[model samples]
Target: MKKSRILLSTALIMVLSASSVYAHPGRTDSNGGHTCRTNCTERWGLEYGEYHYHNGGSSSSNSSSTSKSSNSSSSVKKSGQSAKEIATQKAKKAQQEKEAAVKKAKQIKQAEKDGYADGLKDGYNGISNIGISKYQGAYNKGYKEGFAKGKLKLTNEKNKAYRAGYSAAQNGKSSVVPSIYQTNKALSDSYLQGFERFVIDVEKQKYYQMGYNDSFNMEKYIKPDFDNANHIRWYKEGFDAGKKKQAA
Candidate 1:
């Protein structure tokens, strides 16, 4: 009986160990894979690799899109600024052109006021400034020379012009003589009276040529009402009366 019990005990122990090995599904891999431990470790590693790849791909795509958007925004800003700059430049250029045109018009109007010939003489005064030195002396010289020349040129050019204007006016075309031209001559004559006196005092000598030329009809303007025959008759009467007194 004791021997029978021992055999039964040994058989029970062998069955328990064999059953534990066969029943455990975690002991070996199914589906022709490696051992359960090795397969599970490798599968987990593959899952980690896939996760990294997906994260990396998503990150890279997002980064690329973000970089492109930033670049586009910068380009848009640059293009807007470029347009603004171009518009600003155009505005400045237009303003400068307008100012220049206005200045030129003023100069032309001033030139026309003096007439064509006098305008030409004034241009030489501007050219002579290049050689002028000594502020006070040059200023005085330039002013005097420019004034004298301007007057002389105006007088010479206007002599025939005034005669022509007078003839035209007598012929009944009063509208032909510009008002500005008349005013210009009057202003010049007025300026000459003051300025010539000032210069004669300053220079202590006659700096300008005095006396009118032969063509100037001083008798016509200065002695318009004087009668030449009456003056001659009066002189003869006075001389005859003086001779009678001396003879008596």
Candidate 2:
């Protein structure tokens, strides 16, 4: 009987220890929670010393809250990244546009410069046709200004050539256009016109003076060379006028 009683006592102690192992017996804190210390994995499926609730608290609710927080954080991060990407794109586009504008401006400047040079050359040479250009407006503006300047220069040069020809004729020099004006038809024509005017004036004055002197002295009429029809006509006209003056 004594041995059976001792055996029953041992069995009762074993049952109590087993129940304690599974029961998680501990004084509850203010939040009805405590750290797992016994059979943590087997009884609660948790790590040792991990905090958990046991007063009908739902772990799924806590898990859902944590998941929602993580999702919110992820969304914020994604939004920040998206905004940064947009800003980067905007900056890149702006830079490209700025570069393109600068390139266009440079092209316009170059076109104007080329047009001015071409227009100056053409105008100076008396050319009338203006060719095509990529930047037509800028090129046309430059061309107009250049053409005006070139035309003025040509006019001044032509006038200078005329004066030179007139002086040469007045000094009885050869009626030859200068080598400088030989290549330009306009200047050559101007020089020739001046030379002819001076020669005609001198011939008329000489014929008129000779007729007057002869008539006043009562000399016989001296005729001019008939090789030039103009000389003959001028001499005859002068002789008639001088005769009338003497009679009056």
Candidate 3:
């Protein structure tokens, strides 16, 4: 009986050892054994039974796809930023060009104004001096009439006036009688009256007449020789005539 009991105990130990070894790779439960493979479908309610078998490959493929998606997003962002930068640069360039054009236009307008002012000044000077060759004949006639009679009248006042007129004619200055007159269409009647009564002597009367005629009447006389000895005299006459017309 003692030997049978010992044998029975040895058999029980062997069966327990075999069961422990099988249960080593899984957890024991009343239903069955639950391994990582069975737990995936039973506990987690996975529809696919091959989940654990292909878990590593599926995870690796998903990671690769995610990485590719991230890279594509980054590329699109970079491309969009580059396009925006290009557009911004073009807008800035266009604004600068527009400003430059406006500045150039302003400069051109200022230049035109300056040119017009200069032209007006030159025209006024030309009218006052009558040194322009086109009017030289009238200037000469006035000078001859005033200076010749001035020789006969030895009085201080007459001589002084004659000398002044001669000097003015030589220097291409405006006549004393009309002063530096502006070229306006309407003549001053008072100025003409003042001129007629200004000088009284017979010799002075001829001088006055010469000056008046030359001042009011611009002759068709054109000088052939600009460098002639009488060029200044002719220009003086024309200047007087032009000056007189302002009050004619």
Candidate 4:
């Protein structure tokens, strides 16, 4: 019985050894390249032509598979790199476009402010000059036509200034004033005085009509009768108030 047990133990040891070898089918060859172990191709059921072993234990088929795997890995890396570069370029381009849009908006707003400020100052100066030169005799029939034309001129200027102010405010550039507020205020004061005492009923109507046509936002004056001195004063006050408010 003891001899029979020893034989059974030897057979079990041989089975375990064969299993370990079969599980590990790879080994280094004489040429320092990887190859299948002896009898591995047959044990794994691989065809002889697909995994033929030479005397040096090298496998041509396995070497070709390793090369193909390496090439596939390299190609995947290259494709990933190209996609990343394209995404980076698109991000840069989008940023540049956003910056350009902001810059253009700023420039357009600045231009609008410049136009308004220049028109206000020039119009005020011209109106003041006309008041000094023409208001004394505007009641005469011969001078009435020229007086009407002069009011239209001043109305055009006021319209230009108000339109620009509105546009600048709308474009988010309201804080940047192209003209001096104090200068506008002082000019408005003089215009208010001239509008009160020198302007007659017909002239006031003409001015009010002109305001309704083009300068409604800048000047809102109603026609005043001879007895309503208070109404005339209100017209000047309204003009000054509108100017100061817009400039601010």
Whole-model lDDT per candidate: 0.43, 0.75, 0.45, 0.48
Clashes of 4: 0
Better of 3 and 4 by lDDT: 4
Q: Using lDDT, rank the candidates from best to worst.
A: 2, 4, 3, 1
Off by over 4 Å in 2: 1-81, 208-248
The digit string of per-residue lDDT tens for model 3 on 101-161 reads 9987666555544444433443423322222223344444443343444433323434344
lDDT of 4 at 153: 64
What lDDT tens digits, residue by residue, belong to model 1 across residues 1-248?
A: 99999999999999887554423233322211122222323433322111112121223446776455444423211112567789999999999999999987665554443343333455333332223323444344445555566656666655545455545444545333455454555433433343443433333222111112211323221222325554434444444444454557
Note the residue pairs that clash in candidate 2: none
Q: Count of backbone clashes for each model?
A: 0, 0, 11, 0
> 1-81, model 2: which lDDT tens digit per residue?
999999999999998875554357666576545666777777766666666555333345576654554444232111125
All candidates' TM-scores?
Answer: 0.21, 0.55, 0.25, 0.24
- For model 4, residues 1-248, the per-residue Cα lDDT tens digits are 99999999999999887655535446534443333434545565433223322222324668776555444423211113477789999999999999999987666555544444444444544542222222233223223444445556666655555555445544545334345332454334433333332344445565444433432354544454536664455555545555555657
Clash number for model 1?
0
Candidate 4: 10-residue stretch with minimal lDDT: 130-139
Model 4 bad stretches (over 4 Å): 1-81, 127-248
Q: lDDT for model 2, on a 0 to 1 scale?
A: 0.75
Provide the lDDT at 154 for model 1: 62
The per-prediction CA RMSD against the true structure, in angstroms, equals 22.6, 15.3, 24.1, 23.4
